[model samples]
Target: MKKILISGMAAFILSLAVPCAVYAEEYMDGRTENGTALSVQAMAVTEDIHRVVDVLKTGRMDEGSAGDASFWQLGAGTFSMSRNIMEAAQAQAPAGARLSSYTQDDLYILAHVICGEAQSYPDDEQLYVGSVVLNRVSHPSFPDSVSAVVFQRGQYACTWDGNYYREPTPQNWANARYLLEHGSVLPGNVVWQSGGRQGSGVYIRTRYHCYCY
Candidate 1:
């Protein structure tokens, strides 16, 4: 729903004063390649909020929300939409569903990092790259967003050595999407990976790297 920003949903995280008592069901159903049915009809008052929620659940949007102002309204609705959708995006890992927490840009950033750091590695290892990134996002010591963690100073060689700039292949996108949708396969505490850098603990080891907490 990138069209959401263009549709007038600006950054209101810090400025928003409205109290949003958003409640969402964490369980998703109607197993399909798309997504589950949301009981979000209660919140779909605005045309844009309805549209955005439908896209998240059904995997279809008339236009990219990023470039269209009609996709979502600005201000209070933005906070409501984002907050509720984030709660809606969460899923049990074994459910194997899309989290929808990462936006298009967020997915692109994640896919790029996965490709950059573990392209040549085996499937499990490549997937591990994404798990590690997600781990860092939830960790106390790292930034809270995917882009921030991937681009943080001295955190990854790929970001500074030009590897991060390479075009991510479809497989890279698949891996990133898989991790986000299905929840990370790695443990939440397993936040560190690869060589040189140190971690508090080790959890798994593949052909190319050690996954650590």
Candidate 2:
């Protein structure tokens, strides 16, 4: 009886250990995939960042080809607009985190970082604001830069309230910077909040019918 009981206990322990190990491996694999996705997105965003910078430096916009478009439609205003956008996105970050470089990796990182931040806002508005910002960047009609899209005239409530450019708490900025540098987007189409226009309705798409508080 003693031998049987001892054997049973050992088997139970082994079973638990096996699942735990498998779970850990899965978790690590997910993390690795996430990192790769973010890196790819960041590269794309970095290219757009460079284009925006070039347009800012030279008043003339580069329309590369029929398929290619410049960072922003209005070439003359890109410098100031892009600067404002970057400042606003930077503000959304926590205090210590300063934008080191606008790399392709940065774009993927920004999406995850912003999504995390968006979680703090009311749940009803999180997807709305997130989708709006993402769409603004992904869409060719809007400025290719994240900063420009966030701070455009009357887009974000945070920007309108002057919080968009305000310095973030140091810890928050550091966390945001880390995520932007390391995070990736999960698979799925980005979703935005939908409802009647709240304040900055003009900047959002009507189809979603989402509102941001």
**Candidate No. with top lDDT:** 1
Cα lDDT of model 2 by residue, 1-213, tens digit: 733543354344334333333322322223455433433433343444455444445645434553123333322233333343334333332232123345654444334434434524443333344444554455455666666766567445554554444443444344444434533121112223344544322222334343322
What lDDT would each prediction earn against the true structure? 0.62, 0.40
Looking at candidate 2, what is the lDDT of residue 195? 49
TM-score for all models, in order of appearance? 0.52, 0.30
Please write out the lDDT profile of model 1 over residues 1-213, one tens digit for every residue.
Answer: 544553334334322211221212222323332224342422342444445456555655455556344444434555665465444434422222124477888789988998889876667887888888887887778898888999999888899899988988888889888888877777676778876334653455556787765
Considering every candidate listed, which one attains the maximal TM-score? 1
Total clashes for model 2: 22
